[model samples]
Target: MRARIAGVAAYLPEHTLTSAGVEARVRAAGGGYRPHPTIVERMTGIASRHVMRDDQQASDLAAEAARRVLAERGTGPERLDLLIFGSASQDMVEPATAHIVAAKLGATCPVFDVKNACNSFLNGLQMADALIRTGQHERVLVCTGEAPSRAIRWKVRDRAQFVDAFAGYTLSDGGAAMLVEAAPDGGIFYRDFAAVSAAWQVGTLPGGGSMHPRDPEFTYFSGDGRRLKDAFVDNGPEIFCTALEKTGLTWDDFAIIGVHQVTMPYLEVLRSILDIPAERLVVTLPEHGNVASASLPLQLDTAIRSGRCGPGDRVALIGLAGGVSLGVIFAEL
Candidate 1:
């Protein structure tokens, strides 16, 4: 048996924060350095991003998307043989967020969390596929609730701080769920992943860990965006290119290719590198911002709803995370 993605769902909060609004907030915070108007949009190509309500937790967003997936499949959470909560953000640090999500959805299945920066969902899918192929489980729910906005640094102290926290400005709070089940026919066909562990310092959320357990200063996200980009570029696209070579498939073979998007320039760079057709790509960063682990699923759901891709169609999920990891998962929907 193979693991197939049976259902995909996404949820974005109603509230939006425009790039200009981000600058306004920074200025309002009485930071010493004042940013020029439209700088955020100009640099990142992100017009706006979703913001979760103050009362909403990461589990709440994940549960919302999971509910939609369960409803669409005409099943209940209890039927899920496994649930994986995959995200960069969590409601807390003690209990795995998966447990919290399971409680909210009334699911008693075995659960755990997968954290690998933005590639969390892709890793979760990879694990689910392996487990199903090994006959350990029949159905798995892979979900993510990313509230990166909660850690965004609005109080910019200077140009250095702003540049370090630039990546946070592109983040948007959202949730996504993908139901993977056993299918004797079409399912995940190929997957590849690579990472440069030495590049881990390129980006980070330093709070809640042993290094900075009580340091309020480490609560916000900090990173060198240029370094992170350089790390990926240096790591190269062998994972994706090798997949195509080994599978005898070209970019055109996939009906839809959902690449984890951060900025328009970077997306174009990757597309050019891989030679993916324009029509096959989904551009969500402009309006949705970078939804972290939710980005790929959001693109898949959009493509399915927009009639861009459907059942029996070939799809590719390409992931890039801050840890400078790369991944590719090709499947037949």
Candidate 2:
């Protein structure tokens, strides 16, 4: 038996924050260094991003998406043999967010959380595939709810602080869910992942951990965008090339290729490096910003709805995270 992606769904909050609005907020916050009004849109090519309601928690978002996926498949929560909550943001630090999501969805299945920055969902899918192939589980639900908006830094002290907080401005709140089930048919066939652990310091949200348990100063997202970009440029593309070599498959073979999109320039850079065709991509960065772990699923859902990909079609999900990790998963729908 193979683990196949049976269904996928995505949820985006109604509220939106435009790049111009972000600039206005920063300026209103009385920051020491004023950013140019067009800087955010010009630099990142992100016109706007979604914002969750103040009352919504990470579990709430995940549950919403999960419900849609379950309903679409005509499967109840009880039918899931396992559930995985994969996200960079969580409702709290004590109990795994998976437990909360399960409770919200009325699912009593075994659950856990997987955290690896933006690659959390991909890792969850990898784990589910392995478990199903090994005969440990028959069905699995992998879900993510990212509320990076809570950690975005609006007030900057100076140019240095603004640069450090730049990545946060590109973040958006969203949720996604994918159901993986055992099927005697085409499914996930190839996967490759590589990371530069030394470059882990390139980006971070330092709060809610042992190092800064009570420091309010460490509660915002900060990073050096240039360094992060260089880290990927130095260590990324080889994984994709190697996967193709091992699988004897070329980029054109996939009907739809969903690559994690953070910025237009970086997406173009990766596309050029890999020689991926323009039409193969589902470009969501401009409107949705970076939705963290939900990005790949969002793209897949979009492609499926638009008839870009469907049953018997090959698909590729390429992931890039702040930990400077790169991953690729090839599957058939």
Candidate 3:
């Protein structure tokens, strides 16, 4: 059985944060010499990023996206059989984000959350695939939202803090929704997916967890959790290579590669290391930055709506995130 996207929609907060604007704010706040925001953004080809209002969290952005997607698909919230929230910045820890989305969208169906750092959405896709395969649910609504920039520690604490702030500048808040149905439809169809984790490698949100032993007053966090970039880079080659091997195809089979984009540096590294062509990969992080789990879907929506998709077009969705996990999956558009 093929799990396909029935409809898709996205929501970017009203605010667009430009690199120049951020640089100005940092300079006015008495920060030392920092590279021009354009200089940094140029590296990723990103022009601007969106930040949600203080009152908004992942739930709000996700619900809005879900509503739009269902409406555009000519479906109602009541028809949704399954709802999944993929996120790292959920509104609460006790109750899953999917519940909140269901409440907001008036969905009384089975709702849950998928958490796996940046790979949450891919994980959700994998789960939805299973439900479709087993006939447990005919249709599932997958949603993702994140605001890594908002949680970034902007204050200069030490050398480690600099990397955290550096990473933060590349993060933006956004939401994406895709209504997936168990049908061999005209839309993109899910193929295969896999995930692996190495938790000791990289992490954020060390405050509340028992492993960190946090003391907000006495304890401090630098956010540059030790070679986080290296951890991701190290896993890049084997991940994509494995995906290709499983599909019994070569780089030539694909038209575009949509990887979990965090920076231009990472994209270049992946391209060179994975043997994927420069033109085959799509880069949106510079303008959208790292919109968390919504990264790939938002790009997919843009490509499809812009008339960039075609039959027999093979595409890869690669994801990397919090658990120090990496995922690469094949899909037909």
Candidate 4:
């Protein structure tokens, strides 16, 4: 048995924050230096991105996507045996956001969460695949609500700081849901994950943690972009090629390659490293920005819906996160 994606849906908040809007905000915040809005667009390939309402919770976004997926599949929340809310953003610190999403949907299924920064959704897919293959679960729902835009620090004092925080500027708010059910065969066939603890400090969301619990002002996300790029560039090929080797497949085998939507240049880097053809890749970062865990499903669903991918197409999911972790999943649609 394998875990197959029966349906998938995505929800983007109504509010759109364009690159110009972000630039205006930076200027209003009295930043001594602000990059031109077009600079962000040119570098990150993001013209605009969704932003959640101030009053909305992450669970709200996840529920909306989940509702659509369930409705499309003609399945009720009550029929799901497991719910996994995988995201970088949560409703709260203690209670899992999955529980809140379940409550919103009036579901009584077992609920939990899986967190791996931007790779959360891929990790959840791996877990769901294992459970369904072993008969522990029949129907599982994986959902993500990402709002990294909320963590942007608009008060940067220098160009370097602004550049370091550029990742946050590219962050968008959205939700995506996928319904995974047991299949007789031909679902997920290969998966791999690698964690580089040494490179963990390259990128981070520094806030509300035990080490710096008192720094209320440190809620903004930051990263050494050049360092991250260098590290990934140095090691990315091995990471991706190993997964292809494990599956006895090559990059040419996949019909559509869905990668975590971080930035345009980074996606190009991945393309160069893996030698992937332009047509074989799905590019969503330009319109969606970096929706974190919701990115992969959103890209996958968009490709499928747009006729860019068809039934029995081999889909390759590649995820790279702030933790400097890489995960890959190969599945047949």
Candidate 5:
């Protein structure tokens, strides 16, 4: 038995932030700020990014993507057995984001949010698969919405960290939804997934959660990237390798690799560490930056639609996020 995707959809922000635009804002703000797209361009490999307006929320963007997924699959919310939302950005602290997305979609299904930082979606996928495999549910809708642009702290003290955090430039406002069903036949399939967490040292916002005690200014739930490279280096390869092993496969066995890419170095490093082909890696960070959890799904949808991926294409979604959480997932596209 295999848990496979029935449909895939994405929602990208209407706003575009270019190199010139970012420079202009930094220069005008002038709190010892200057325009620098060098790392952003090199790391994310994206030339531009989509940003959500202050008025927009993660649920709004997620609903848009969910609509696309449902339409593409010819599915209605009424038929959905379970809806899982993977989000770090939520409108309220008490209500789960999944319920909000369901409400917006006119869905009356059992819904909840899965949050493991940027790893939320992959975790959600795993849980949905477990539920389906155990005959607990069918037609599980998996959603990932990230509006990290809202929480960006442009003023950082660390220069090297900021360069990689240049992911901020590539990080955009968007969401992705995919319909996962029990498939014993041909369909996009999930092979395996694994997660690990270190000390939660690298990525985090100062305020918002109970640990920091929320403040008005910290409402965005931002993050710090001072040691992003360290976070990736610490556990990315290990978790990714474990997933591949669980599936009885190797990095070289897959046709395409899609790591949770926020930077170009992430790909290069993972490729080198795992001894996978550079060409085997499918990257969208250069064009879209990091769409948070949506990054992989959005890029995967585009790659499939654009003929870059084909029937029987095996792709890997691997990366690390805040809380020092790291993981990898194997998908058969």
Candidate 6:
């Protein structure tokens, strides 16, 4: 048996932030470092991105997306056997955010959380697939509410600090949901992951965890952007090949490929390495920015809804997270 995606949906916050707006903010913040509006737009290929209200929590976003997916799948929350909340943002530090999301959606299913930075949603999909394939669960709902805008370090101390947090500028807010169930076929054809734990410190939120106490003004994003590119360029070929090998399909077999929404440059690198043509690739970064874990599914939903993909089509979703993890999931729709 295979775990097939019955439906997919996404929710984007109403407020939109443009690169020029970000430039204005940076200038007003009195940071010694300044980011040019055109530079951000040219480098990341992002003109605008959605932003959730400051009052809203990640669970709220997740619930909105999940409700849409449940309705589209022709089922209620009561039909879900398992609910997975996969996001970089959580409602709180104590109780799992999954419980809050479940309550919001009126779902009484077993709920849990998965946190793998930007790869959380893909991780949840793999778990859901395993459960369905093993007959442990029939229907599973995976959702992510990524609000990276909340943690962005706006007041940069210097040029170096600003450069380090440049990736954070691309962060956006969004949610996505997918429903998977046991079926005879038409599901995830192959899935796999690779990690370089030694490079885990490459991307980080320094002040939120145990090592560093929370500081509202100091909650800045940090990462070695060059190192991330180097890692991807180095490991992408082998990791992607392994997944294709498992499915006995290559880049030529996919109708559309969704790579992580980091930046246009990163996508270009992957496109070259994976041998995926520009026409066959889906580029959402220009419009959505990086919504973290929600990005992959959101892109997939956009592709399907826009008629870029249809039933019986093969698609691939690739993920890269802060732990420097890489994953590929190929599915048939």
Looking at model 1, report the run of 10 residues with the lowest lDDT sum: 229-238
For 190-222, candidate 5 gives per-residue lDDT tens digits of 444444445565455556568667675553333
Question: What tens digits encode model 1's per-residue C-alpha lDDT throughout 211-262?
Answer: 9999999999899888888887777587888999999999889999999988
Q: Give lDDT tens digits, candidate 2, residues 188-306.
A: 99888899989999999998789999899899998998899888888888888898899998989999999999899999998998899999999999999999999999999999989
The CA lDDT of each predicted structure is: 0.93, 0.94, 0.74, 0.87, 0.72, 0.87
lDDT of 5 at 304: 75
- Which clashing pairs does model 3 show? 46-286, 46-287
lDDT of 4 at 310: 67
Better of 1 and 3 by lDDT: 1
Could you estimate the TM-score for every candidate? 0.99, 0.99, 0.87, 0.97, 0.88, 0.96
For every model in order, what is the number of clashing pairs? 1, 0, 2, 0, 5, 1
Clashes of 1: 1
Model 6, range 8-62, lDDT digits (tens) per residue? 9999999999988887888788867777658778878899888999888999899
Regions of candidate 2 where Cα sits further than 4 Å from its true position: none
Q: What is the lDDT of candidate 5?
A: 0.72
Clashing pairs in 5: 43-263, 43-264, 45-286, 46-286, 204-223
Please state the error at residue 71 of candidate 1 in Å: 0.3
List model 3 lDDT by residue over 20-49, tens digit each. Answer: 776665556554545554655665556788
